[model samples]
Target: MGNWESRLYSVPPQKLGEFVQNSLRPFEDCQNKIDKTVNTICAVLQEAEQFPLVISVAKGGSYGRKTVLRGNSDGTLVVFASDFEQFQDQTKSPSEILHKIRDVLRVWQLTTELAAQVEVQMVSGTLTIQLSTKRQSITFKVLPAFNALGLSDKPSTWTYLELKRALDQTHSNPGEFSVCFTELQQKFFKNHPRKLKDLILLVKYWYEQCQEKLKYAPLPPVYALELLTVYAWEQGCRTEDFDIVEGIRTVLGLILQQEQLCVYWVINYNFENVTIRNILLSQLRSSRPVILDPADPTNNVSKDKMCWQLLKEEARIWLSSSGLNESPGLSWNVLPAPLYTTPGHLLDKFIKDFLQPNKIFLEQIERAVKIIRTFLQHNCFQHSTTKIQKIVQGGSTAKGTALKNGSDADLVVFPDWLNSYTSQKNERSRVIREIHKQLQACQQKLDLEVKFEISKWKAPRVLSFSLKSKVLNESIDFDVLPAFNVLGHKNSHTAPSPSVYSELIDLYSSSDALGGEFSTCFTELQRNFVISRPTKLKDLIRLVKHWYRQCEKKLKQKGNLPPKYALELLTIYAWEQGSGTTNFNTAEGFRTVLELITKYQQLCIFWTVNYNLEDETMRNFLLTQIQKTRPVILDPAEPTGDVGGGDRWCWHLLAKEATEWMSSLCFKDGTGEPVQAWKVPTVQTPGSCGAGMYPITQEMFSFRICRTLE
Candidate 1:
C-alpha cells in the first residue's frame, strides 16, 4: 500500500488516543510551572506605583483558552488601562501605547528582586518580558488594549459600533483592535467540549508538522486553523464525543477547498446591526479564504492568497497520506462558506449592482448596433444576387438579460437570394466571407476601428469582429451571421404557420447535421419568446445566466457543456410552472432551476405557446424529438432543435456542480433552513399541466400529449 495507508494501519484508534494523552497533553509539572510564571507576570503588572494607568490584566491567546499544547511557553497579556480612552479615537497609533507599557516593564525589571534573572525587550512593536530561572524560561507578550467590552460577556450593538468606527479609521494592522476584545476571543474557544479540544490539539499538531516541513514557507495563521477546527466540529458533529479521525478528515477536506473558503461566526457580532452587517457583507464578498476573527470583524486571518496556496498544497499531501479515501462518508457534510439567505430586496439590489448593464453601456451598445445596421443596410456584397434583406438583433442583448461588462450583440443578416434552407446553407459561407472583406475595407470610411479574429476555416458561418470608438469604455464584440429569413416579417404576437416548422423538420431530417441547425432563421421569434416575459422573470433569467457563465469558466477546460440558452429556457419553464406572477422570490426561482439541472436526465420541458400539436406532421416530429433522448428542451421558436438533448456536451459536470450548489449558503434562508424549491417536476408531462401552463392557441389540439411515446 501507499505511505498514507501504511501510516493509518499502523496507528489504531486506541493507540492514537493513548498517544494524544501521553505525547500531546501537557504534564502536571509543566502546567504548574507555566501557571506560576503567568501569576508572576500578572503580579508585576498589578504594581500601581510602576504603572498608574493600568487597570487590570487579562490572559489571552491559547493560554487563556486553556488549549495550549505541552512545552508552549508563549502567551498574551492584555493590559486594559482607564487612561487610554484618548486612544480609542484611533488618532493615536498603537505603537505609542506599546511604548508606554514597555517603559513601565523596563523600570520594574531593573528595580525588582529578580532583576538578575529577568530580561525585558521590545519585539515586533509588542512589549516582551522573558522570566528565566534555573529550570526553564517563559516569554510573555504585553499588549495594551482599550477594553471596548467593559463588563459584559455579550457587548451591546452601540459598543461594537464604536469599536468598528475606531477600527475603520486606524491605519494600523486590522487585528490591532482585536486585542480590545481579547476576553471574547478567549471565551469563543474556552467553552468547547473536552473531545472537541482534543480535535483542536490534533489539528494543531498536524499544522506544526507542516510548518516544520515547510521551514520558511508562509502559512495561514495558526489561530485561523484553530477557528477552522472549531467551525468544522460545530457544523459537522456538535456532540462532545465524536470520532477524532473523522474530524481530522473533515478539516483536511475543507483545507483542500481553500480557494473558496469563507467561514465566520455570529456569536460576537452579527448582521442585525446595519453598520456591522454592511461591514460583514463587504468582508464576505472579498477574495476567498476569508476567515473573520470571531471577536473582531475587521480581522481576516486567512487573507494571504500565497500562504493559503502553500497550506493547501501541504494539506493535499497529508490528506492523501491519511489513507481515509477508502472510507466513504467519513468526513462531515460542511460547506466551505456559510449560507447567506438573500431577501428579495437584497437579491434585486444584487442584480442591479452586478448583473444589469448601466445606461451608458446600453447607449454604447445601441450606437454600435446603429453603425453596424447602417453598414448592413448600405454595404454591397461581392455576389450580384447577395443583397441584404434585413438584419435583426438577437441573444441576451435583445432579450434584456445581458450582464455587466459582458458586451456582445448577435446580428442575424438575412440575404435576399437565400430564399430556401438549401440555398441559404450553400451560400451563407460566401456571404460571410464577403461581409468580412467589406468590414475590413470600410474601416476608414466608417471612421471606426475594427479588429477581426482571423478565422482558420475557409467557409466560416459567422463573421466575428469588435468595434472600438471614443464613446465606448471597452470594444463591443459583434457576430454577423447570414441566415435564411424563413419567418420574413411576421407579427411578434402570432406564431409561424405549421408549414414553417414542417419545412424545417423535413430539411433537418434529410441532413446529417444536429438540431438547431436552422435556429438562426427564427431569431426574431426566439427573441420575442423571452423579451415579452414579466420583468421579474427576465431578472430571474439574468441570474440564471450569470450562474451558467460562472460554471462555464470553471468547466471550460473539461469540455463543452450545455448551452447557456438551455438554462435560460429552463428558467422560463421553472417560472411558468412554479409561479407565473410578475413578482416572486428570486432565490426560490434560482434554486428551482439548479435543482432541475441536477436532475437533467429527467428534464423533458417544452413550451407549446409558439407551436402546438394541431398539425399532423408537426405533432409527429415533436413527438419524435422529445422521445429521442432524455433532457429534451425543444426550442420554442424551432421544433427541430433540442438544446438540452445533445451527445457532444458534458451534462454530468453541470449536474455535479448544481448538486454542490444545493448545499451552499445561497440556497439557505435567514433561519438556516434550506430555501424550498418550487414543486416543479423534472420530466414535464402533459397531464401535469393546469391553469398555470403556457396558454395554448384555440387552433391547437385540445388534448395534451405525454412526453413518453404512445
Candidate 2:
C-alpha cells in the first residue's frame, strides 16, 4: 500500500468523527466575545447624530452566516446608507460614503468611551474600514452599501432588475453592489441544517491549512470553499448526522475538478424575468469555476482561474493524505456545471449566444474547406495510381451544427482506383499513407503547419491532422478518410437506388467487416440528412450535441460511449417522431432526447430517407441488424451500419448521466415543475415487416414483426 493508505488505515473511522467533534467545536467564551464586539460596533454605528446617512448596520460574512472557524475572528459589517439610493455612479458614490465612515471611525476611536480599546484605519482606495481591538486583537472589515433588498426576505423582480442595471453600468467592478445583499447572503447559509454548518467549518479549517502552507500563492476566497462545502453536503449526503470525513473527501475531490465547476443556487434569483434571465445565462456561460454568489448574481466568487489552480494543487496533496484515504469514488455524483431551469425562449437565446458559430468563423471554416479540397485534388495523390475522384466535407461543420470555438472538418476522399467496398477496405491504408506523404511534401506550398496524430493501429482508417495558419484565429482539425465512390457524384438531395444498398449488404455479409465499415462512403448522404433539416431543428441538434459533449467529457474515464453521430441521428429521430413541424420547443425536444437516452435499452431507431425499405435485401438486413442489439440506431445512408450497436459502446454510463440530468433545473420549467418530454417512442415500429429472409421470434424481440408477401 501507499503511504497515504497506510496512514489513513491507522486511524479508526469513528475516531475521525470524534476528531471533528473535539477540534472543530466553537468555544462559548470566544463566541460571547465576538457577539459583544459585533454589538458594540453596531451600537456605535447607529448613533443618530454622528452618522446621519447610515440607515442601519448589520454583520455579514462567515460570522453572520454562523460558519466561522474557532480561532478566526474575521468578520464583515455592512452599513446601509440613505444617500446610496440616489447615487447615480457606484464608482464614485460608494467611495464617498466609505470616506465619511472612515472619518467618523477616526474621530470615534479617540473620543468615544471605548477609545483605548479600539484602533481604526482606512484600507486605501476602497470602501473598507479595518478596526482592531487591542485586548484580543480581533479584526473587522466595515463597508457602506445600498439597501437593495430592504426588509423583505424574498427579493422582488424589481430588486434584481435594479441590481442588474447597477451591475451593467459598473463593469469596472461588477461585484460593486454585492454588499447591498448582505441579509440574503447571510440567510442563504443561516437557515441550513446545523450539521451542514459543521461541514462548512471543517472545510474552512482545511482551507486555512492550505493558506498557511501556500502563503505566497493566491487562493480562492473562503466564501467559495464554504459554498462548495454546502453544495457537496446537499447533493451527496443531506441527512442531519451524515459522515464528516465523507463530506471533506467530496469537497476535496470537487476542488480537483475546479476547472469544470459552474455552481449557482436559485434561492435568491432565477430565470423568470427576461432581464435577469439573460443576465444569469450570460454569467453561467462565463469562464470556468463560476461559483455565483447566491445573494448577488453579478458576483462570481471563484472567477480567478489561477487561484483555483493553486488551491487545486493543494487539494490534490490533501486528497492523497491520511484524511481522505485516496479514494476517488467517495465523492459526490454532482455535475460541475449547474443546469438552469430554462424556458424554450431562453433555451433558444442560449443556443444563439453560446452554441452557434459567428459569421466570420463560418466563413473562415468554408475558406479552410476550399483550401483542403484544393490540396486533395491537385497535390495529395499526384504520384499514386489511386487518384482523388471527389472530396465531400462532412461532420458538424458541413451539417451547419458546428459550435463556437470548436472547429473540425471531415473530408471524405473517394479514390478512383477503389471501386468496390472490398477494395476500399483493403487498400485504404496504402491510400492513407500516400496522402500523408503528399501532405508533408506540399506542406510548405500551402503556407500552413501540419501536426499529425500518430495512430496506434498499423492500418488506421482515418488520417487525422491539425492545421495551423495565420488565416485562422485557432487551428482547424481535419480527418481524411478514404472510401469508395459508391453513390458516384449524384445530387445530395436525391436518394440512391436499392441496388446500391443490395450490393453493400452482400459485400458486408461476406466479409469480416464491422457494422460501420463503409460508413465513410456515405458521408454525403449523412451530411445531407441533417443539412436539409429546418433551421430550428438544427438549433435543437446543437443543444443536444452540446449536452452529449458534456457527458462525453465527464464519462470518458468510464469507457467508450456512443459516438456523436448516433446522438445526432437520435435527435433527428426525436424531432421527426415527436414534433415534425419546422418550429418546436427546444427545451421539450432536448428533454425528449435525454429521456430517450435514459431508455437506451429499448432504443431501435432508423430512417428510410436515403435507402428504400421496400427492397428485400435492405429490409432483411435492417431487421437482422436491429434484432442484434438493444440500442440499434442504424446509419440512414448505409444499410449495413448499426451506429449504436456492438460491445464497444458503454451506454449505461450515458444513461446514468441522462437520468441525473432529467431531475436538474434544465428540465424544469419556470414554475419549478418538470418540463414534460415529447411523446416519442423508444423503438421505431415498422409499418410492416417483409417475409422471412431472417427468422423473427417473439422471445427475441419485444415488438411484433409481420411477414409480408414478397
Candidate 3:
C-alpha cells in the first residue's frame, strides 16, 4: 500500500503549517487594513450631516469567517441603514436602499491610506472600493444590509420564514435578501476548529492559484469549499488535531466525488418541521453540488455545473500528485481530462469558442447539408416523379447562429408537384409519406458512417431524422419539410409577392385559422430574413439562443414553450429598433431580447421586409391577427402565422431568469457597466391602428407601432 500520510507529509509537517501561515500573512494584513478602512468609513458616516441614513457598519464574509485567502481576499462591509425598516415598510426595492446608501457614501470625500480620495464604482447590485496603503491594497465589497434582528439570539422559525417570505413576495428580485441574514451567516462558521480553518485557507489558496489556469471555466464560490471542509470534519470524526493536509486532500476528494452533496445545519431551524424540511429538501435536490448556506436555506452556492466541473477537474489534477494519488485497493474514481478548451473572452470570440459551432462540427454539418440537398434533388417528388424545385437551408445553422454542442438544421424542400395552397393542403400527407419512404431508401443506399433515426409525427409536416456521425461522435438533427415555393429563388432581403400569402388566406376557413398551417410554404422566406442580418445581429441571436437553452436545462422546463424562432425574430426586431448596425454592443442586444421576453404579453411585433399587406385579402388577415391577443410576433414571410403563441408560464420563467442574469458577468464588460437595453418598440393597440396613416414604412401595410415599457 502506498504511504498516503508520507505523500501528504512530503511538504514537511512544520513547513506545511509555516508555509500556509506565511501565505496567509498578506491576506491577514489586507483584512486588518480593510477593517480599519471600514471603521473609518463608518466614523465618517456617523459624523457627516449629509449621511443621515447610515446607522452602523461591521465586517462580514471571509474576514468574519477568518478564512480569507491570499492575493485578492474579499471582505464585506455591512452598512446598516437607518431607513432600512422604513424602506421595508414602504415596500422599496433592495436596489433602491442600496442606491440610497451608495449616494450618501459617494459624498464622503474621505482620504484613504494610498489614494487621495477613495475610488468608488457603483454597480447595479453593490459598491466596490479600493482601499490601499503605501505597501498594500485591499478590495472590500460594501454590502448595504438591514439588521432585521439586532443582537438577538439565533433566529426562530417564524423570523427566518418571514424574512424568506418578504424576499419572495417583495420586488421580484432573487438575491434581494442576500444580506438580510449577514449576522446569522457570520455566526454559522464563527467557532470552527483552528485546523479546519487552516485547511479551508489551504483549499481556498489552491482555488485562487488556479484562476489563471482555468480562466474560461467558472469556479464554485469559496464559501462552498469552506462548507465542504466543515462537512468532511463533522461527518468523518470531529477531531481538533486532525491532519490538516489529510483534511485538504479529503475536501478536494469529496468535491471531485460529490455528484450531489446536500450539506446543511439544523441548529437554528427545525428540519423535523414539514415546511422547513421541504424547503431544505428542495434546496438539496436542486441542480448539483447543492450546498445550502447553513444560515439561509435559499442560497444554493453550488448550482452551476460548469463551476463544479472546473473545480472537479482542478481537484483531480491536485490529487494525481505523489502520495495523494489513489492508494492500493482505493479508488479516486476520477473522470478523464476535459477536452482542450479554447480561451473565452471578448463577447464574439467567447460565443464562437464556447457557444458557437467549431470547425469540425461545422464541417460535419456541411457534409450533412450536402447529403440532404442531394437526396432532395434526386429522390424528392416532381409531378409524379422524384425531383425537387429548390432546397433551402433554414434555422440556426443556415442563419449562422448555431451553438457549439447544440443545434438543428431545417432542410426546406420545395417540391415541383405541389402547385397551389389547396393542392398542398390536400396532398401534403401522401407527399410526406413518399418523402419519408424515399429518405429511408436514400439512407439505406448511401450507408454512410452515421446512425440515422427517423421519427414519426402525427401531421408529419417535416421528415425528422437525427444523424449521429461516427467520426465526429456528435449528432445533428435534420427536419426535411416539403414546401411550395411561391416566391422563386431570391436574396435574403428581396420581398415575396403578396399573392403568395393571398393564396394562403384563400384556404383558411376562418380568420382564426391563419397560415401557421402553411408554415412549410414560407420556410424559404424565414431562412432568408435572418440570413441577411448583420454579423453582430447574428452573434446576438446566438447569445439569446444560448440563454434560452440555459433556461430550459437549468429550470428542467417541459411542455410547449415559445419557439426559438420567435426569440430569434425578437432579437432582430430589437436590433432594428435600436442600433441596426454591424458594430453594435452584443451584451446590449442580449439584454434587449431578455427585456422583450419579460414583456412578451405586451409584444406586438411584425415585419414587412419579406411580404407586406398590400392586397385587401392579406391586409384584413394581418390586421385581425395583430390585434388578436398578447405576444403577437407575426411571421414576416407568412403574416397569417402568429409565432409568439405559447404558454405564459415559459415566458414568466424566462423573465425570472433575465432578472437574475442582469447582474451576471456574461452581460457586463470589464468596467462592470451593465449593458443597457434599448427603449422597447412602440406597440400599436387595436384602438390606435386606424389612425388614418395606413403604411408605417414605405412598404404598404408595413407599419410597426409598439408600446415601449415605461
Candidate 4:
C-alpha cells in the first residue's frame, strides 16, 4: 500500500475550492454529532459497571465508524469479531447498547471530519445550558449527480480544499452542493451526510497538506491522513474512535496525493492452532527434504458431517470476541464433544491457522497473560483464584500482524472497573509487562528474539488493548484480551482444569469426536444458516421481515406473545438474527463481527480447497498449493508434484538456470538427485520399484528469501 500510493502535487485552483466546499457543507452538524457521542459516553459512564468498558468508550477511533453514537458498560462492540461463542446475556439490546458492527476494518467513510459539538449538559441527568434549538433553510445549486459522476469518469483528482469548500457552500445552500458531488458520492452522502462531510473535510486539509508536501518529497499513502488525525487527537480528544478514523484517513491521504494509486490490503490469513502452525512453517524452512503424509486420505475439516446450528452459534460468538465467559467447551451445536473445545474455539483456531508460519506465538500468549497476572498480583489485585477471575478478566488473540522485523503483538486487554482502578496507572502497565516478559520468554524458549505491544483502552471502567510482536526472521503476534473476572459471580477464583488446557492442545493434533448428539446439532444448524445467507441485502431483509411476520402471526393465537413483544423478541433472538449473544455495540464490534464472518467464509474456502469428493483433483491441488506456498486452483492440464525442492526459490536469481541445478541442490518427492540425495538415504525398493533415481544429500542445503513484497 505504501509503495502503491500516488504522488500528485496539485489540482486546478477552482476545482480545489469546489471540492473543499462540498466537504464542509454537510459538517454543519458537527456540534450535534459530538453531543450525541458525548451523551452516549456520559450515559454509559453514569451507570457503568466495568472499567475496560470505559477505556473502549475513550478510544473511539480504534474500532470503526458509526455515527459513533455512544459506548456501553460491556464494550462488546469493539471485540465482537473475537467472540466466537455466545455470551450468557440474552435480553440486552445490541443496537441501542452498542453500534451494530460494520464490515471494513480500516476507516473508510471519512477523509475529513464529522459534525459534532463536545456537548454540555446536566448535573446528574438534568440539563443546565439552555442551548438554542433552531433551524435554517440553507440550499445551494451547483452540479447534478449525473454531471458529477460523468466528471469523475475522467482521470482526475480534486483538491481537498475544493471538496470542503464545495460542501460548506452546499450546506450553506444543499441545492448547490448536490450539483458538485459525484452521483456515487451523492448516493453515499444522501444516506450518510455525516460520513460524507467528514471525508470531504479530511481530504481538504490532509490532501492539501499532502499536495504541499509532495512539493518537497514522496510520502506514504497514509502520511497526510495519519498526520491530520494524529494532529486532531493532539488538538483535543484522542478518542478510541481515532483507530478507525486513522484507517480511512491514511488511505485517503495517499489517494488524494496521487490518482492511480493501487494498494492491496491483506484481507485475511489462514490457520488455527498456534503451536502446530508455527512448527509447520519452521519445518518447511529447516527440513530440506520435507515429507507430508500423502498416504493418508484425510482433510482438515469435516464439513459434510458438521452441525450447522452449532457452527452458527460458535462462529457468531467466538469469532466476535476472543475471550468469553468460559474457555469454550464442547457445544452440542457444531462439533462432536471431542472435536472442538467450545463454541468460542472457532475464533481461537482461526487466528492460529492464519499465522501458521510465525514462530514465537505461544510464548507471547503466556507472556501476555503473565503481564496481567503479575500486575494484579503486585498491585491492588489479590491472588485469590475465585476473586481474581471476576475482578480481572478478558480474552486476547495474537498473530503476525506486524510491519517490521521484530514488531510487537496486538495484545488488547480490557479489565473491568474494580481491576482497572485497583492499581490505577500500573493497570495498563501490567499488560505491557506481560508482553515484555513474553517476548523475552519467546527468545529464550524458541531461540527467537521478539517484540510485542500491550495497548489499553480508556473508557468507563475499561482497559482494552492490542499487542503486536515484531517480525524478524518470522511473523508472530499475540492479540490477547484480558478480561476482569466476575466479582460476586460464582466464577470468581475458579480455575480451569490443567488437563483441559492440555486437552485443547491435543485436540488440535488429532481428529477426535469430542461430543456426539450436541456437536451434531450444532454443526447441522451452522451449516443451514451459512447455506441460507444470500448475497443480497434485500434478500436478507426479506428473510428477517418474513421471520418477524411469522412471530406476529403467532401473536394472534391464544397463548402467543403480543405483536409488540413479538417484534422486539424477534430482534432479541440472537442466533436467529445471525448474531447470537455476542455483543456488538460499537463500530469496533460491528467491524470485528464482520471480519469474523469473512474469516468463517475463508474457512469454507480452505475446506473446499482441502476436500472435494466430487472433484478427484482437489487433494492433489491442495497438497501442491501447500507445498508451493501458493494458492493452487484446479487445472487438469497442470499437475503438482511433492513439495520439497519447490521451497528453494530464487536460486536462479543468484546463479544461472537453477532448474537443472535446483533439483540437484534440493530434494523432490522426498527424493533428490546424486548431490542432494547423498545425505538422505535413497529409496532402494525391491526390483518391483524400477529405480532410475539417484541418492540425495542435505549438504550445501540452505534457505534464503528470494522475494519480498517490498
Best by lDDT: 1
| Candidate 2: regions farther than 4 A off | 1-344, 383-385, 447-459, 467-475, 646-648, 671-673, 688-710
Off by over 4 Å in 1: 1-299, 302-345, 382-385, 447-459, 467-476, 670-673, 687-704, 707-710
Residue range 1-710, candidate 3, lDDT tens digits: 22432333345434556667775545555556666666777686566676576666766778767676655566677777767662144255457655655676676644334232356667777577766654445566777666666667477677666666675666534334656666777777776777778878877777766665667667887788888778777754367886665566667767776664556665667454556655654554455566767777667776676768777877776677554543321221111110111111246765654465556657766776687678668745543564577788887788787765537878877777778766666666776788787777666665454557777655655678776654332566778777676666665355666676676777674544444877777676677777778877888888788778657645664544677888888888888777767898776777788778877778887765655545677656766776666787878777767777744336676777776555444455545455577875646332233112235432333433222211
Clashing pairs in 3: 355-404, 681-706, 682-705, 682-706, 682-707, 683-705, 683-706, 683-707, 684-705
lDDT of each: 0.73, 0.72, 0.64, 0.26
State TM-scores per candidate: 0.54, 0.55, 0.53, 0.22
Please give the ranking of all candidate structures by lDDT, highest first, separated by commas.
1, 2, 3, 4
Pull out the clashing pairs in model 2.
Answer: none
Task: Please give the lDDT score for candidate 1.
Answer: 0.73
Q: Which ten residues in a row have the lowest lDDT in candidate 3?
A: 335-344
lDDT of model number 4? 0.26
> What is the C-alpha lDDT profile of model 2 across 109-207, one tens digit per residue?
676564224556666655443333333334567777777767776888898787767655665476667877888888888778887887787777667
Report the lDDT tens digits of candidate 4 across residue range 1-710. Answer: 12212211132222333444453333445435444544443344434443223222221121122211112111111222112111212112333222211111112113323233222222332222111212211111111011222223221222223333443443432122222222222232233334333443434344334435346443332222322332233222323332323323233322222221111110111113333333223333331112111110011111221222232332233222322112222111111111011122122232233223344544654565565455444432333332233222211122112222222332233344324222333354565454344444443233222333333433432333333334222333333334322122432123222332233223322534221111111122122223333222212222233323333332334343222211111222222233332332212222222222222211111112112222223323333343343211111111221111222322112122112122211222222212211111111111111112122222221111111100
Q: Report how far off residue 221 is in candidate 4 (Å).
A: 17
Candidate 4 error regions (>4 Å): 1-185, 205-260, 263-370, 376-710
Q: Write the per-residue lDDT of candidate 1 for residues 574-605, one digit (tens) a residue.
A: 98788888979887998899999988887887
